[model samples]
Target: MSTQQPAGGRFQTFSAFYPYYVHEHSNRTCRRIHVVGTALVIVIFITALVTRNGWWLLGMPLVGYGFAWVGHFFFEKNRPATFKYPLWSLMGDWRLFFETVSGRRRF
Candidate 1:
């Protein structure tokens, strides 16, 4: 895919980007890690709200990216989608999380 973009580097809508995201995470373990990571991020957000701690914000990317990267390195044995599609990767992470949790995706 071409990395070049328009003048402002605009992006397509999330819906348009989602399929590409799924393609990037074709590995099951990598997708699973992304789901777990997204859940942890939600928990962290709630904890941050309850505790009013600024540091919890630091955990957002860490929890989301850390588990995901580990899964990619160990199980998927492939580079992460984040490197090429940061925003869509993040959106896909959460989308995959919800889809799995809601039973939309078979285990």
Candidate 2:
């Protein structure tokens, strides 16, 4: 498959990009790490809101991306689609997390 675009020249919509996103996260460990990171990000966001301290917000990306990057580098041994498709990749992360939690997808 070509990495230049999502199945074609470009992904016209998130639905179009989703399959590619899932494909990039084929590694089970990578998917689990992403799920964990996303959950932590959600918790941090809530903490930031509850404490009314914006500083906690700063760690959101760090926590999320840190786990994800480690999974990609060490487990998946592949580059994250985030570099090429930031918005879609972020959306995919949440979608995958929910799917896993709902038992629609394996963790």
Candidate 3:
């Protein structure tokens, strides 16, 4: 089933999209991958701060997305929300990452 929003419309709000986000990350490996990706993003952010190189900020999405997509392709075996909802997918990525790290998420 296509989760695509209808033309000239926005997708569901983050709250509504949350359950689907959790469903997409149901696999433990996927969850862990997201965690690592999120950590890498933080590292990149720190590097950017220390070096004062704004370009390093670009690496955040690269680290976050590259690792997450690898997990989806090899383990979750599903399409990434990036293909459908780029911003929300990124938000969901970080949200899920924190949830996993904080032990608030059930695998």
**TM-score of every prediction relative to native:** 0.79, 0.90, 0.84
Regions more than 4 Å wrong, model 1: 1-16
Locate the minimum summed-lDDT window of 10 residues in model 3: 1-10
Q: Which has the greatest lDDT?
A: 2
On residues 3-97, what C-alpha lDDT tens digit does candidate 3 reach at each position?
44446865658876767777787788988888888899999999999999999999888888899999899999999878988889888987887
Clashing pairs in 1: none
- Candidate 2 or 1, higher lDDT: 2
**Candidate 2: tens digits of C-alpha lDDT, residues 1-107:** 33345444668888778887888888999999999999999999999999999999999999999999999999999899899889889999999999999999998
* Residue 102 lDDT in candidate 3: 81
Return the lDDT, model 1, position 103. Answer: 99
Question: What range of 10 consecutive residues in model 2 has the weakest lDDT sum?
Answer: 1-10
How many pairs collide in each candidate, listed in order? 0, 0, 0
lDDT (C-alpha, whole model) for all candidates: 0.78, 0.90, 0.83
